[model samples]
Target: MDIPAALGGVSTALTIVKQLNDIDRRVDEAGFKLRIAEATSALAEAKLGLVDAQEDIRSKEAEISSLRSLLKRKEETVERSGYRYRCDANKNPIGTALCPVCMDEGRFVLTIQSDQSGRPYVCPKCKANFGYLSAFQDP
Candidate 1:
């Protein structure tokens, strides 16, 4: 379970194997039994590690599913708030329809013309017009 306990088990197994080897040097049947027992305990430890790895995989999958759902909820909220939404960049407005610059998505707006450039660009939020600078100056 804990590191210290795990290490302790390993130490015990090694000690048993070493004692069995000493007995083997003296040519006895009891040493063979000790070796078999130690090998069985090591196999059990390997099975426990396999189980822990499986649990870790399941935990990570659950976390991924939760994050996916959260992202979906946020995307729906943004759409409901009337932000211009477009997964693609090259979509042209239907008829004179345009997206509000505030929303930045190409939805729910009347068709509008670009500035003197005669291009087609609408604000994401209001879909009125998209411009970086006003044509008028106070100075």
Candidate 2:
């Protein structure tokens, strides 16, 4: 054909190819940005789950500490008077001759005998006297 017309057609073909290359590059960049957004969201959700697990562990530790304190109090009561209950055949408890004087010091000293009327119980271990306590004190 004519020389000028052939050069014009070649120029149009080169322009179309350049436009297609630009569109391909923009599409690849958009895909990469979308993947980055999704990964960021997943990481945030994982961090929230870790925080929840830590709170649960703290609450469990507090409950364990409270239970330990209650156990210590029960042990102290048992050491103060372990065998103070003397139940009869009808399950009625009779008072023991525990001296109140030594009990204040966390010692379980029993008086060997009492007066005839059961009052003024005397303890031979510490040489102390005490009145008769009720049977319903602590078992």
Candidate 3:
């Protein structure tokens, strides 16, 4: 459930608890039965709120895991010129140039393609062009 729904459930529980506290010392059997029913409903709502909170925690944990994995991949890449490239075991840059725009956004490192002139690299995913020395050129 969403945060607002969870909060609503908790709020309803608190309200019911306050009402139960305000009951008179000399209560009739029917009045006690009604209070018990209200308390049970409030408890159910509170349980739902707890379940929602647990689900939210699990979702956040999954997101954190994914971000950590992405960060690890980013750490393994090095930026050269205007593009990003994967590094070898020795930390040496390797493979084709990756889209710098995508890399900075924590997206996958899409390989930038070379045009006929080979003077600039173009990213197929974002269509962003990086003006740099051709990959075929000797540095």
Candidate 4:
């Protein structure tokens, strides 16, 4: 499956072909049969290498698609009133407030913990304290 092994297989096949071409009509039948078998084996190895390379390409493509989806979701999020929130398809903010510090660092959404009064208090994830916000209340 390694690229170098695949290239080596192709090189071996080519060498066999050249040798076969250079052989005179007086060459023994058994020796020619052996060379033909060797060439067949080399070609098979090269084919396997090509298959493995194709598989690797497909795997990488799938990973890229998944990452793009995550990035699109992240972009859909909104920051408001010193907090981060995920948005709906209509661009309306939804769910609990996320920690602004974690969001700024490009970390995963870490919901901010609030007091019983629904006021911004602290972040459970990053442990950031938002002390005594008299004006800011979670709705």
Candidate order, TM-score descending: 3, 4, 2, 1
Evaluate model 4: give its TM-score: 0.62
For model 2, give the 10-residue run with minimal summed lDDT. 73-82
Q: Tell me each candidate's RMSD, in Å, in order.
A: 13.1, 23.9, 3.9, 5.0
User: Candidate 2 residues 1-139, lDDT tens each?
Assistant: 1334434444554554444555555658775555445445544544555566567678878978866774553343322244343344454544553555665555556665465665655777787755544434324
Best by TM-score: 3
Local lDDT at 2 for model 3: 58
Please provide, for model 3 over 86-122, each residue's C-alpha lDDT reduced to its tens digit, 9 standing for 90 to 100. Answer: 7777666676777877877778755555656555667
Candidate 4 lDDT trough over 10 residues, lowest sum: 130-139
Deviation of model 4 at 92, angstroms: 8.8
RMSD of 1: 13.1
Clashing pairs in 2: none
Clash pairs (backbone) in predicted model 3? none
The C-alpha lDDT values of all candidates are 0.50, 0.53, 0.71, 0.73
Q: Which model is ahead, 3 or 4, in terms of TM-score?
A: 3
- Per-residue C-alpha lDDT of model 1 across residues 1-139, encoded as one tens digit per residue: 2444455566666776667656754576766876868766965675565566667778889978977775553354323123323222233212332244422332334334455576655544464655332221112
Write model 4 residue lDDT over 1-139, tens digit each, in one string. Answer: 3677789899999999889877663767777788889999999998899889888888989979977776776788766676656777665667666666776565655565466776666778788887643232334
Which residues of candidate 1, in runs, are more than 4 Å off?
1-26, 79-139
Top model number, lDDT: 4
TM-score, each model?
Answer: 0.37, 0.38, 0.70, 0.62
